[model samples]
Target chain A: MRPSSAERASSGSFELFAWLFMRISGVILLGMAVFHLFYMHFVFGVERMNFNTIGARWQNPLWRVFDFFLLAFALFHGFNGLRVVLDDYLSQRPGWRVLAKTLVFVLVVGLMSIGGYVIFTFPAAANLAAVP
Target chain B: MKAHFKIKRFNPEKDREPHWEEYELEVEPTERVLDALQTIKWEQDGTLTLRRSCAHGICGSDAMVINGKNRLACKTLIKDLGSHITVEPLRGLPVIKDLIIDFTDFFAKYRSIKPYFINDEPPPDVERRQSPRQRARFDDTTKCILCGICTTACPVFWADSRYLGPAAIVQAHRFLFDSRDQGAEERLPVLSAHGGVWKCRTVFNCTDACPQGIDVTGAIAEVKKLLLFRKL
Candidate 1:
């Protein structure tokens, strides 16, 4: 009924979604990361890991899609975590905190764009180094 | 048994900063820390000051740092703390005197949460009754005594004063879950704001610090869930 209460009510759901995103993305990242690690490091082995080996795997398209999701989730999750840390540490400085968060947002967008492009568009054809 | 107490004392009129004073007294293991303090005030140092009433855990006025943990001086027995005990005022609050901190900000935060029943309907001739199960919904949070221990114990509260703090959230939980209360819509927004429930990092210090054994972290989590889903 009061002005303060009304203002608070009109506040966006950004914090709510951010909190939810952390938990959801964390669970997803954990599952995808563990699978990728085990499959790549244990099953595929580090000895034979070269550009051709990745090329052969990405040729299937499933791994490309899987790796893309992994890249996006990991970046978002890790940066969001850094955002929280920034929030905690820079709480005293409102202007600097806003600047830090904006920079982080730009950095995440840039990293995601580059990573996504590589995962989706990298050549799957055998090139200079074939594992065979 | 002999008990040695190291109490943090400060007098703005005389001292520039808080200093620890040690007192040695013969005490029984079953005797409470409040008993030792009383003895010190009565027999040893009449200037020793602390806030206490009821001489039991019910009042929650005796909440202070007992050996690095938030606890009621009345509830803490000499046996548990052994012969040596360290006492200090609750952290993150301005101390007015020895073992007494300013509670102005603390109570302001609590009041902001709007702790109390809010129901506007034609009253029944009998009473606004609730099922036992309905009452059980907010049973844990009903025990809050506004002790300020949970809030003071919270690291988030210590780091940032803007946070609503754990005690306030627990109070909000009490009314929010009540079947009769219609204040959730109002309370949820206040909590979802910048310094609201989202600031809780799930640290269990509030739960650990509650003298009434209320699951403070659990209550906050429940409020977060309620805000997310607006149900249960």
Candidate 2:
């Protein structure tokens, strides 16, 4: 549908920042993913998989923080991409658009919170339990 | 075939508001929308107003919103659109009369892109030579005929007049990618603004609406990539 001339000037920096963030975050995510892929497949290989390997990797806080950043950025990036898709298809349907927006928001928040807590706190929890 | 052409008519001098007037006409299935419009004006109503230079698709003066899509009136067949046809001026422009919208705002954005060549260096005695690959880079965007269909179909342009609509961006892409052009740096800052190429969400409406089959979305993406990488 067409918008009248007077309604055309919706100016704000928020959408501009979002657009910039998408390009920057996309580049960062690409680097992070390629690094992870090389480390897992070529450097260590899949045959090294075991609970002990996981326990050894989490001993360092840096790796834990790296995984946390990866999880958070990837989840938000994916859902924001979905937001564009939802708007393109469901913008005309107000009710359905609201439902879709709510669902994506909940999923992003839930995944980030759960991933953050486990990634950042599991190492501390293990140390506390080891005291006994 | 018998068909009802529902045209949105408005004249500032005569009508207080735009109205849809249906003209019943007998047109062949293969007859173009332009032909149907001609029937209405020639036989039924002499005062019907529209702009069309070439009856074929080359001129691009008869772009209108037909059955919810922006298309070249000379190109769309009546049979393909079925009997019931709705013709309105292109969206996001001031309608002056029946099927003719003002292009002043559109051309302003185009002029802002500096559509002409802006290289400061001296040219050779012959053509400033460009390899086939260099020409191929911007070939798709050069086909734009200033139809305004792609611009009107763009939702971003509809929401923000400040946004340099798809047509303008495609025009910029043409020069930015040309090997002989040295004005990319000058044009880059202009397009780097908030309402620049960043506004494109790649919803594909502009590409779908282009009558010349130009890959409008792809050109936009190329411009974005050029901005991100600073290669152009």
Candidate 3:
């Protein structure tokens, strides 16, 4: 007899999520990258970009929000891209695939955790004097 | 050299449980694993079942898991393997019997990507000339022999069979990057969709297992970059 839908659902569908994440993240990265290029290169002249300028920019809540968005999207897009590559090339054995992907997940999580912490707690104005 | 082979055996009609059968054979150092298998089948066990053709690595028909790695039996030398060998069917595929795995699902995903050129223009009376550099762009992708080594070596396929796997994506890449092929627009969405190229995790196993030495991960990465940065 065929299994019910619930049984299949309960089996877990993480691949579906990963596939969806790639498309969504790819779209978001597109916007974020363009905006980043525009603001950093076009709006703020290259010559004016010193430590002080960056410090002053971060002092504003809006800039902090913008930087955070860039950081999150870029990291996720890179991690997802790496995941796809791993799936394509890694050994097919269940044990080996699980072990390798687990390692990748742990490393990505670790990097993201450190980056998120730094972004959230970054001192906005303390480095103003050092910026020049 | 004399070596022992421990082969996994299963018969749905005769046996309810799988078992291992050992065969000892005298073989030359340079003789391939397929040679030893042939020796056993001809001289010792006629009922021993397996699949092989061409006796070379080109056909991709002899792929199996040997010493915990996916490889073509026709290409692996017994001397390089060691005193004993463990041979089994490729993983992530349905087992039809002792060594043959059903390839229906594997080929189905292969065909889903529309593995052919799709140009709207009619064929010219004369052959279409391509620049040497343009032809170089697709040179590596054209080497794929439809070998399941990369697909069976992939972790994504093991976890999710629905994934198009590395081989199919690499095949899709063959056409996607070809200058003569104008279906990149239509192929990109399908290749980047669910169970498509995006599902691959770049572990480099496909690159390692590919008997043709094709850069499988590199092809997948190029596809991802195209989908991400290129419009449509």
Query: What are the DockQ scores of the candidates, in order?
Result: 0.31, 0.08, 0.07
What is model 1's native contact fraction? 0.24
Number of backbone-clashing residue pairs for each candidate, in the order shown:
0, 0, 16
The DockQ of predicted model 3 stands at 0.07
lDDT of the candidates, in the order given:
0.88, 0.83, 0.79
**Candidate 1 clash pair list:** none
Q: Which candidate is the best by lDDT?
A: 1
RMSD of each: 3.0, 7.6, 9.9
Provide a comma-separated list of chain B TM-scores, one per candidate.
Answer: 0.97, 0.96, 0.96
TM-score of chain B of 2: 0.96
Local distance difference test, candidate 1: 0.88
Tens-digit per-residue lDDT, B45-118, candidate 3: 98778889888888888888888888899999988999699998888887888888898888887777779988
lDDT of 2 at A108: 95
**Which digits, one per residue and each the tens of the lDDT, describe model 1 over residues A1-132?**
111555465655767888999999999988999999898899999999987778878888988899999989998988888887787778678799889999999999999999888888787576525434
Candidate 1 regions exceeding 4 Å error are A1-11, A126-132
Q: Mind giving the per-residue lDDT tens digits that candidate 1 earns over B1-232?
A: 9899999999989999899999999999999999999999999999999999998789889999999999999998899989999999999888999999998888787878789898888789998899999999999999999899999999887877778899889999999999989887777777888678998998899998899999999999999998889621
Checking candidate 2 for backbone clashes, the offending pairs are none
Q: How many angstroms is residue B103 displaced in model 1 relative to the true structure, after the best TM-score fit?
A: 1.7
| lDDT score at residue A81, model 2, on the 0-100 scale | 79
Ranking by lDDT: 1, 2, 3
